[model samples]
Structure formats: structure tokens, C-alpha cells
Target: MVTRGTEILVIKRNDPAWPGLTFPGGHVEAHESFHDSVVRELKEETGLTIKKPKLVGVKQFYDDDDHRYLVFFYTAHDFSGKLKASNEGQLFWMTKDELQKQKLAYNFDRDLPVYFNDNLSEHILDGKRDELF
Candidate 1:
């Protein structure tokens, strides 16, 4: 997530698999570090260069085919360049309160605590019954 003051950078995802509002991120490429991937994805999707993205937590789940997926969550306060949207979706800024009122992506509501709460570190969805743990 990218933030400035009380506003957060958000993306209304166009991808059919996960369509709704969420933060900017993508898959980690081969031979790339996690931190570097964050920087690259932000630049590619949001037209911003992020610095020192502190890995705050992670969100993990499994697909219908039992393929495990892990989303590394990071929060960055230092960023540069003008904001722009990619094929992923539209980009905009919103406060925590404003975000709560918007249509969030699947399971994103359950994932919010990990980003806002200092005590939480992970959002895990045990695929069986779609329960949060």
C-alpha cells in the first residue's frame, strides 16, 4: 500500500479473477527479491517509485484447483513520481474511512486489520470453509 497523510493509493482491479478495489501489487518474478518486486510492481502499475517498503504482513489462500497463493503485504510512505493507472485498474487516493465505504475486493475486508493494526501480522484463509484465522 502507498500512503500520503490520511490517504491511501488504491486500485479498482480490472482482472476478472479478482475484481474490486485493492492495493497495487503483482507476482514476484524469477530471480527477483521480494522488496525489489514491490518496487517494480508499484512503478509498473502506479507510475511511482517506492522506497523502503516495510513488509508488515502477508495474506495467504488456495485457489479452487488447490494452488496456494501468497500475497506479501507492504506499506510504503516514501514514494515519487506522478500517479497513473495501468491495465490493472483505476488509481485514486482514499482515507481509511473512505475505503471502508467503498466496494472492496474479495476477502479484502478481512485483510484490512493486518494493514492497519500493529498487533496483527497475517491474514490466512484456510480454504476449507473460507474461514479467517
Candidate 2:
């Protein structure tokens, strides 16, 4: 996940799952550290070249489609580039307060507040999605 100021960056996904409001990240490449993957995925999805982001947490999801994902969450204090939308979907800069006002994609309400409160690291690292609520 990438955040600008108090606002978090969320991608409106084009796929079947949720199809909107996802963190800016994806699968880690071979031989890549989780941190490096976060940077790479951010650039690929958001078109922003971020400085070294601090590791916050990891989220693993399991769905009926045999879907499994381990998402590495990070926070960046600085970055350099223009914002461009990726094939994933549109990008929105949502402040913590503004989040409740918009039509957020599913599950975002479960996840984003953790990121906003900076408690994402502990929950994710512990594989505690169920505890989020």
C-alpha cells in the first residue's frame, strides 16, 4: 500500500474480485525481496517511483478460486513521478476522513483503516485479518 500525506492510494481494480479500491501492489518477482517488490509493484501500478518505503505488514488472502496472495504493505515519505493509471484500474487519493464518504470497493473497509492507523504491520505480520473487525 502507498499513501500520500494522510491519504492512502487505492486502485480501482478491473478484475472480478472487488473490481475497485485495492492497495497498490501485486506478486513479488523471483529473486526479489518483499521490500523491492513493493517498490516495483507500486511503480508498475501507480507510475510513481518511491523512495525506500518502510515495511509495515503483509496480508495473505485466500478465496474459493484457489486465490492466495501475500501482500506486503509499506509507507513512503517521499516519491518522484507523475501519477498515471495502470491497467489495473483508476487511481484515487483518499484521505482517512474521506474514505467513508466514497463508494469503496469491497473489503477495503476491513483493511484500509488499519493502514490509516498505522497498525497494519502487526496485524498482517501475525496473519490476523479476522481480528481486524
Go through the candidates in order and give each one's C-alpha lDDT. 0.91, 0.72
lDDT by residue for model 2 over 15-124, one digit each (tens)?
87666566777777889987788788889988999897987655567666656666555778688899999888899888767767677676666666556676445333
Off by over 4 Å in 2: 65-69, 119-129
Query: What does candidate 2 score in Cα RMSD to the true structure?
Result: 3.4
Residue-by-residue lDDT tens digits, candidate 1, 96-123: 9999899999889988888998988888
Looking at candidate 1, what is the lDDT of residue 20? Answer: 93
Pairs with backbone N, CA or C atoms under 3 Å apart (clashes), candidate 2: 56-121
Write out the backbone clash pairs for model 1.
none
Question: What's each prediction's TM-score?
Answer: 0.94, 0.78
In angstroms, the error of model 1 at 72 is: 0.6
What is candidate 2's local distance difference test score?
0.72
lDDT of model 2 at position 52: 77
Counting clashing residue pairs in each candidate, in order, gives 0, 1
